[model samples]
Target chain A: MAEHDALTRERILEAAEDVLRRFGPQKANVVDVARALGVSHGSVYRHFASKADLREAVVRRWLEGVSAPLKAIVAEEGPAPQRLKRWLDALVTTKRSKRVSPDKELFAAYRALFDESGIAIETHVGELARQAAAIIEDGIARGEFRPVDPDETARALLDATTRFHNPAHAEEWSDPGIDASYEAVWRLVVAGLTV
Target chain B: MAEHDALTRERILEAAEDVLRRFGPQKANVVDVARALGVSHGSVYRHFASKADLREAVVRRWLEGVSAPLKAIVAEEGPAPQRLKRWLDALVTTKRSKRVSPDKELFAAYRALFDESGIAIETHVGELARQAAAIIEDGIARGEFRPVDPDETARALLDATTRFHNPAHAEEWSDPGIDASYEAVWRLVVAGLTV
Candidate 1:
């Protein structure tokens, strides 16, 4: 019975994402999600306290999916340069496919998380950036990347990647084009401080 | 009499920009503008045909203002490398201070322009980019910048500047810190492409 409940929860979460992608967040309601799952609305309520609770779950799921690859890349033992490349690739892919719209409901969720004392976007992104910076700092120590301020370098790297991935700018790049573009970025990083 | 007419038109255009910036596009109505300016709404109609006409004047004013310095940089006969650096500095400075908030009714005006034609946002930016590319292409010809695809190099340069200017990413940079950051960017661009 516990396993069946968990399965239904997963089904509802998947349906929620589908609704979000199709109708955007504002229109993605409990009824729509249940209809998508061919289940009764009561079943959704059994899993979630309310629509807000379910939406939060969907958002949390999206955030986890987005960051998982970064964690995996960081965990692997490799040279920092290669690790950075993999991280960039992962970031681009994630940003491109992740939530494509800034609907009002989506903005509200971000605002809610931002207002919460325990949840902050900066903290989440900063922690990942610091980890990436540590890798670059190590690379500099090993004479792989140029010797520059790791924090600043990490920020620039992230900034460049962010602009590249933003939907407003994504149309400017194709998948293959982005790969080669990063090559220019890599060369710039290496040239600035490489011995 | 003609000079006085031009002054009233200029005043109305400035007033429109101020209203849009303050209240966003929806509230930037002719009635509101008249109330703000102590003029009859009918008087505004005497100078401009409609809100759409006023918005076009405002956008054109903004584009011309932003592009003016870059134009001067290009017009001057000098080494391509020197001109490129000056152009970038001028471009970034212009973009950083002059931002069009999404709240501005100008967005709808831009949308209307798109509907009338197929011109896209990137293409709009691309026109300015091609102008900047000319400087880089000249540098390549003179063996200042590296011999690469000038258009791609141009896009990358604009991409860097655009990211630097986006208001959402404003916290990513500090005014005092941005110059150093841009220097780092310049180093990267030079390293990757400079011959």
Candidate 2:
């Protein structure tokens, strides 16, 4: 019964994603999701307490997908500088791809939901910062980085790179010189981190 | 007659600003602006080509107000590092003030207009980058900073500090530890700039 319930929840989330992509957040609703899944809205509510709860769950799942690869990078054994640079580059690539065609419309659909899913976003940001802090701590231990507070330095790195990954600047990501711009910022960031 | 025309244009802009502030961008229109000025909508159109033009002009005026002080900072004869730090601090303070009460409602109204005024925003951002570049060039000339490409470095600096000044991150500006966060980033930036 527990396995059946878990499968049902996964199916519901898939349906919700499709419904959101087809109709967008403004028009998408639990009824549409349930209709897509050939189930009653009541059944949808049984798995997810409310429409907002379902939307938050969908966003959380998507954020988890974004974080999974970064987690692997953090857990890998490497010189911290290379790992950190690779991590930042991967982040920029992932964010830019989401802002482009194919995923762009789906991302747009979720972005509205994101505005309402504050808890989900906060959790995602906190987790990302923690991962960055782990890298910084390792770098410090290896004498590759300055003896700065790892958490604070990690937060600073994220904030400094906000333009590269933040959705608000998504439109600017396509500019031809954007990669060079990111490189310039990365050079400065590396200089700051090195002992 | 030229002076009279200029005065009339100024009066129309003032009325337009009031109308936008009172009704917001969604509801505000040239008709409302004309009503505020006790003139026909045609009179407003005579000074401004269309609603978009009028909105762009309003945003340009506000942006000019924001840039004027920074221009003064750039023109000041001082150590480049101190001037740059002071300029960044002033920008953060100005952006924060606009996000707070009194100006906050007006800023919200204009923010919608700003979205449509891409040319105005781009020009404003370009001008700001130029101002920062001038300071960086001065620093390099004085042996205060490493010989980096001034324009590119300036752009990187702006991008790195975006969270402090960009409207999208206004909510984070009010965090109690935000100043410390900015200081941390600034220290890194200074390290990057200094030889």
Candidate 3:
């Protein structure tokens, strides 16, 4: 019964994502999700207390898809600098793909959901920062990075790359010179971290 | 007669600002601006081609108010690093003030105008980048910094500090630890430039 309940909840969330992609955050509703799942709206509510709760869960799940890979990079054994660079590269690639993907409508829907879902965003940012700090901590232990506060430095690193990954700057990401510009910034960041 | 035309144009822009402050970008119109100035909408149209043009001009003026002080800092005869820091500090202060000022309605109105006025924003960003590049060029010439591409490096510097100045991150600016975070990023930036 527990496994069945869990599977039902997962199926409901999947239907919610499909509903969001079709109708966007402003138009998507629990009823639409329920209709998509072929379940009653009350059944959907049993899994998610309210429309807002379900939307937040959908956003959380999408964000987890972004961070899960970064978490893997953080856990890898390597020089901190290389791992940091790879992690940042992965982040930029993921964000850019979301902005300019073939499924732009779906991405736009998720972007709207992301903008309104504040708690989900905060949790995602915190998790990303923790992963970055783990890499920095390892670097410090290996004497490969400057002895800075790992958590603080990790946040700084994230802030320094804001233009590349931030949704607000998504429009600028498509510029022809954006990759070169990101490389310049990356070089500067590496120097700051090392020198 | 030309002077009179210029005065009339200036008056229309001022009235437009007043209308925008009260009604916000969505509800403000040329007719409202004319009403505020005790003139016909035709008189306002004589000065601006369309409502969009007048709105763009207002946004341009507001952005100039932000960039003008930084331009002065750029023109000052000082160490490049110090000038760069001062320029960035001035920018942060101005952006923060606009975000947290008592006149939130006015700011919100202007923020909407800014978001939509693509040409105005692009021009403002370009001008600011030119000023930053000037300082970086001077730094390299004085043997105070590395011989990096001044324009590229300046762009990187601005990009790195996006969180502090970008309007999207305005909510995060009020955090108590924000200044420390800016300082930390600034230090990293300066290291990248110097070392």
Candidate 4:
């Protein structure tokens, strides 16, 4: 029974993500999500007390997916500079993907989520900053990157990459167009940090 | 008479920007703008055919303000590397002002403008591309920059700068803080384009 309940909840969350991505946060109500899932609204309500609950869940899911790859890439075997460069490319590619279908909804939904008052996005933002900072600091320590303030370097890279990740700038993204730009970003990181 | 007409147009555009920045695009109607100006809605309409027209004028005004500094920086006597760095910093600063404004309305208005259809943003984007390309080419010619495709470099720089300019990514805007991240941007630009 618990297993079935978990499956139902997962299904409902998936349906909600679809609705939020397609229609936006304002229209991603219980009725719309239920309609998308072909399930009763009660099913959604059972898993989530309200629309806000569901929205938060979706955000958590997105953060997990995005951070997973970065963590793996950092752990992979390669020179620090190469790893850093690939990481930059991966960041841009992920951001570009968010500009495409289905993910656009996630992007929009996250925008709305960020705007909600009392929502502690600081925790999430800090986590991201910490992860990025660790990578640069490690690279610097290994002599694969230039030595600079790890926190500052991490923050700069995050700002550059996150700006590219924005949906409003969606029109500007193109494949292979930003490769050199990404290289520039990695070089900047290395330059500023290199001992 | 022409001068007066031009002045009125400028006043109306300024008023529109003020209203949009204060009340957002949806609320920056002719009625509100006229009221703000202590004039009649007819006067507002005289300068602009509709709210959309007013909004366009406001955007044009904003773009002009942004471009003015860039043009000046480009024209200033300096190596391409130094001028380009300053130009990138200027671009980031201009973008940061809009993103970090306490005026939620202005931010939303900008978002609405991005959503506008049939709006010939191509001219604006093209002009930016040209100006940036010219700067890069000049740098290359002067031996201050590496020999890369100037046009491609400009497009990449503009695209990346445009990403930071977006209001949606406002959260990350100050995380690394605008100034340092921009330094990182310039470093990357120089690294990729420098001979």
Measured by lDDT, the strongest candidate is 2
Q: Stretches of candidate 2 above 4 Å error? A: A1-8, A26-35, A38-47, B1-9, B26-35, B38-53
Alpha carbon lDDT at B62, candidate 1: 58
Error of 3 at B77 (Å): 3.1
Query: Model 1: how large is the Cα RMSD against the reference?
Result: 6.7
TM-score, cand. 2: 0.88
Cα-based lDDT at residue A164, candidate 3: 91
TM-score of every candidate: 0.63, 0.88, 0.87, 0.66
What DockQ do you compute for every candidate structure? 0.26, 0.69, 0.69, 0.22
Q: What TM-score does candidate 1 reach?
A: 0.63
A28-103: candidate 1 lDDT, tens digit per residue = 5788998887777887888898887887677666566667778788767767788877876787777665434544
lDDT of 3 by residue, A1-195 (tens): 453365476788888877777777785678888777666788778788988888888888888889998889998987999999999999999888866646567778888888788888989989999999999889988888888888888888888998899887888888998999899888887787773
lDDT of 2 at A103: 78
The positional error of residue B111 in candidate 3, measured at the CA in angstroms, is: 2.7
Quote the TM-score that chain A achieves in each candidate.
0.69, 0.94, 0.93, 0.78
Error of 4 at B150 (Å): 2.5
Q: How far is A95's C-alpha from truth in model 3 (Å)?
A: 2.3
Model 3 global lDDT (CA atoms, 0 to 1) = 0.84
Q: How far does residue A120 in candidate 3 sit from its true spot (Å)?
A: 2.3
lDDT of 1: 0.66
